[model samples]
Target: MSLRVGVIGGGQLARMMVPAAVNLGIDLRVLAEAEGSPAQLAATAVGDYRDLATVLEFAKTVDVITFDHEHVPEEILRELVSAGHSVHPGPDALRFAQDKLAMRRRLSELGVPVPDWAEVRSEDELAAFLEDHDGHAVLKTARGGYDGKGVRLIRDVGESTDWFRILDEDGRGGSLLVEELVDFRRELAQLVARRPSGETRLWPVVETVQRHGVCSEVFAPAPGTTSRLVDLAASIAVTIAESLDVTGVLAVELFETTDDRLLVNELAMRPHNSGHWSIEGSVTSQFEQHLRAVLDLPLGDTATRAPWTVMVNVLGGPSAGDLTDAYPKALADQPNVKVHNYGKEPRPGRKIGHVTATGDELDEAAFEARSVAALLGSDISIAP
Candidate 1:
């Protein structure tokens, strides 16, 4: 009998995993939030992931459960475990990814390098943090934030009045996460996969370019990373995964500081946007690796397929119509580039798809990827 893996949250991550599951012969099932979700191809059920009855019914069909995103309630996840269902990157490990404030405290306890941060409960607290950080800081809600949403740059306490109000409205009276603005030279991501048996593998750290807080492009192996920097990044990811007892893919977003230090920026306990290039760039894509790790199967080699691979996100599809409308021009403009459309309608700053190119030179690969991405009407410019 084939191994069954049920995924919660049917977004593009779940959609991308479908092809990997097919090749591996694992039965992939998704519990999508709604009809016509990106992962509709493999969606076997549709309902609220937070609903116990809905999720319990879906859990019965799969041998193991994983996630496409981290928004599922922790109580539901723990309940699944209590009922004897296997949930990879189990609730304990997932808590760090779900709540940024919790993540910082835990990472600090683990002696992980991270920016100075605090859980600020009021305007005075935020003001104090800002004053100490050169009058600038990044404020984030503890939960439900991603893709630059639920995040803000603040130099004054007044800027966070609304967030404070929202916190006040919550009966529990939560605190906001405030961090010293990192003086980073460039952003880097390290992708690693850890199986239930504790075996782990890491891909080369990659450089990511963000526009308007959304990932715009990636260059595999992070151009100009010395061997020492590469090793350090890998070490950090491995340490975190093992420390947290994380199962399945873990993406560690990092800040390469101007002082040559690497600090943890954020964590994602599932296949992440940064590793999307691996689909065509590496021998084992993150999507495939995620399934393998969660199933406790032997992981695949993570070596790069080319010397340089570039991934450019199709941030926004054509203003006039669907992504397919630009396919003719996009496909022909860069024949060698690979495009993965999320099958979504165009909207400003939405990630509808991504294009990747692998070649001997970074410049050539980036150009091909960018050219195709531009033709597809990415909101960002093609110029490097």
Candidate 2:
């Protein structure tokens, strides 16, 4: 019998994994949130991920259980382990990804460099944190924040009074996280894969560009990066993966500060947006590597397929019509570029798809990617 892997959550990440599973002869099963989710092609069960019976029932069908996202409740995951089900990047490591304050505290204990942070429960506590950070700080909800949501830049304590009030009303009564606003030159990401047996592999660090807090572009190997910087980034990712006992793919979002210091900004324990370029750029795509890692199979080559690869997201696709409307012109315009539609309907600022271009020159690759992104209804203007 072929090995079966059950994935929780039915987003684009799981959708992307289907092709990899087919190529490797692995049976992929998905417990999608809805009937027409992006991963519906592989979806075998449609139900609520938070409902214990639904999840446990799905778990019985696969040899190992993984996730498309990290929002699954901790208690449910523990129950799976207790019942002898295999879960990659298990609950202990997942908690850090789910809660920012917990992540900061644990990273601090590991001597991982992160932004100065404090957990504040009230307006006065928030005020104190702001006062020390030159009256400006980034406030974040410990959970449920992603792609520019649940985070705010505040110059005064009153700016977060509503958040504090909301927390007060919550029976959980959680404290918000406040961190020193980082002065960074640019954002970077390191992608690594580890198996249950403890062997790990890392890809070249890449540069990420964010627009309105959503990742819009990624430049593989991060143009102009020094060898020392690349080694340093690799070391940091490997350390975190081993220390946390993380399995499957781990994406480490980083800040390359102006003074040349590298600081840990965030962590993602599965296939992430920054590594999307790997689909056509790496010898082994992150999707494929994730499957191998989670199944305890030997990893594959991570070498880049070209000298440069640029990925640009298709944000809020087609101003007035379906994505298919623009495909004719987009494909003809940049025949060399690869377009991946996530089968999602367009909405303002939503990631409907992405485009990638690989070449021997960075300028040409970036130009092709940005050109296709605009033609596909992404809001970004191609740089002249």
Q: What is the C-alpha lDDT of each candidate?
A: 0.95, 0.93
Model 2: per-residue Cα lDDT over 264-333, one tens digit each:
9899999999999999999999999999999999999999999999999999988788888998999999
lDDT of 1 at 143: 97
* TM-score of candidate 1 versus the correct structure, residues matched by position: 0.99
lDDT of 1 by residue, 147-189 (tens): 9999998888999999999889886979999999999999999
* TM-score to true structure, per model: 0.99, 0.98
List clashing residue pairs in candidate 2.
Answer: none
Q: Which has the greatest lDDT?
A: 1
